[model samples]
Target: MFSSDILEATVTIIPLWDSVAYITMKAVILDGEWDPRPEYECSETEADTHKSNNGSQTWKHPALHIENREKPTPESDEVLVKVRYTGVCGSDISMTHADGDRYMHYSAYVNLPNVIGHEFSGEVVETGEDVQSFSKGDLVTSEVTSYCGRCHMCRNGFNGHCENFEQLGFTIPGAFAEYVAVPEILLWDVSPLEKAYKSKDDILKAAATIEPTTITYNGLFGRAEGIRPGDYYAFHGVGPIGLTGMNVARAAGAGAVIAFEPSDERRDLARELGFEYVFNPVETDPTQAVAQVTDGMGVDVHVETAGAVAQTYPAIDETLAETANVVHISNAGEPASVDLRQYQANAAQVYGAEGHTGDRIFTGVIRLMAAGKLDNLPLVTSIFDLEEADTAIEQASKRVDGKVLIEV
Candidate 1:
């Protein structure tokens, strides 16, 4: 492992003085050498070819450092954001996972030596001349995927599958900096969040969650059509997404939330979020636990956020209700055998979702936050300054807390 050279942003009261021009101060970038696995000798198989393209399965001694890179200036249709707060995602850590690491799970559309961070909330420090909808001081959080709106997939209301796309912090520079240039169309006004949170700094902290929260939002609502009122939900993981998603399901009127996590700490965090039922799948049978709690009615909405398909899918298969919806949002790399017969027997639907685009995903999440309906802010258990981000990433690897954020 790269020893958790993490990247995040901490709350910084930006001085948006009229005459002071904003310039990016510093950035956390990833630079490493590729070292492929012996098995990936470029055989004709797709998996082998895919790994071959990435130059290997993992990097070599990937290092994270605060470097003073050339500042980014917005295009005519873009705005320069001064990042205030950012959340560390697992994908960010995978960038630094080295050849000898126990596991390296991310390696698609990733061209490194790139600045890190895709989940962020910030202030608009400058706007391009053509930008009209936003001014310099607007509080904003934008989409991380840079998708061309005119593509066929984008035009058909499936922009998440946009044929032309660039993932922030993956292919390009992202938000782990003093500034990130964003196109105006991808920006969402998060100022309304000020009403729900007493502190502007906290609101910025909350807004940084918009990206990951929407991952679950897109999977459950946009892909699976969401849960009906009074429906029972079963969450396979209580990580940040599960914790925030539990709130999403509740705010949408889910009658009860049942969470199963292998981590004792995460299960406890689920309870802290006010869920009445939380279990450890490692000890108890998740399917039987759900059956016992719901009196055999089973869960109507099944969520997979643990990235452990082998463990979660079987429970999801056994505990599904009639016409149930199974939403897989975890970024699982390995394929698992599925009992397709169960889906047919129960008349259930399964939706595979990726990325947060289209379907008003961002808008709905911001609305929930603005209305004081989301309490997932408690998931943000740790916050660090830009200088201590290395320590932040180290802590994030523990996967014990709901979230860890860096204040810029």
Candidate 2:
């Protein structure tokens, strides 16, 4: 048996031989206005099971239990948020997969048996004494990385590479529960952007998408030499991030935007979203198709959102304009073999664009949404109650073309 308590939250794990463990917890509801319940209990067996609609096993993570544990109290520089909506991300799927062993990569940071959601929107329910920027009831979404400002990387303006970075949903307890305590520095107030959001539902959708949209914005604007008018743009995937990238590129006045997706559902969605050039890589060579469309000039910029290194590397190399840039934003866990001479011959630049620059990208994304340049509501193809989070993750990991949200 393994039992530990940190900051009033207790995790009890009963070992069942070498391969499995049984976990359970009891938590209290903090907000007096919502539910005054003092305690609720949850067990690993009661958690959502990973079975698809077709009766096939789709998840690798063995246990995804929800606990009703003691509510977290924000530290002096933190605030407690009442989570409203949380978006399912590819990283979440990878972390929860059983056969992938992906979580091992972050085992040094993440604590097991923790809540697991990073992309979320919520209202501030309480604040610690030193919290200054936000008050209770404020609608906000926060950057997921909790960086130590004192780190060398943070001092040098590369907070994303902070030497002591603690990522939500990875290194600590996340927003999958009814409430989460977050550092005030990571919070972004979305109240000012309400004018662009028509209703509560619309705002929720925007909040759920802020994280991914900001990542896309960071890649297009912060990493690459921002999109220029009349430039040709190409995307190698049509997932949520890819869709957001395409929308951002179009809004910036790209001359032409093309996408290559293997999923029929995604292809249809790209067309429906007004993309004039959407092709299935299975049907045609993406490099050849892009070359023909650009009249042999190739694309001015290429974004790789699909995590397939083997496919994206060649596609980007073969379809890059002579002096163009390739933004490698995907998290392809494995290494890829690429012809270095192709890059040298073309003089094309390859940038490893990852997370956003926190609030800077979030504010910019909100401004774009306000100006009617970006709208991701259409990308929310599926929504589930918070209780169905496991199912939501399962659906998101499928061949779906859009976003899946959990209403918390």
Model 2, span 1-408: residue lDDT tens:
444454235323433442222122221111101111123232232223211111012222335765556677789999999888898887666555544431122212333456778899999999999999999889888898888999889999988888777777665678877788999999988875677877876886787788998887888888887457989999988898999889888888888999999999988888888999999987999878997889989888898898888887887877778878888888776798777787888888888898986546888887888777787888888998877887887898895748898887
TM-score of each: 0.88, 0.82
Lowest summed lDDT window (length 10), candidate 1: 3-12
Which 10-residue window in model 2 sums to the lowest lDDT? 28-37
Per-residue CA lDDT of model 1 for 21-101, tens digit only, reads 444368998766555566655445324323223433644556788987667988999998999998988877666664455
lDDT of 2 at 322: 82
Q: Once superposed on the true structure, which residue ranges of model 2 sit more than 4 Å away at CA?
A: 1-62, 100-109
Candidate 2: deviation at residue 141, Å? 0.6
Candidate 1 residues lying further than 4 Å off, grouped into runs, are 1-24, 34-60, 99-104
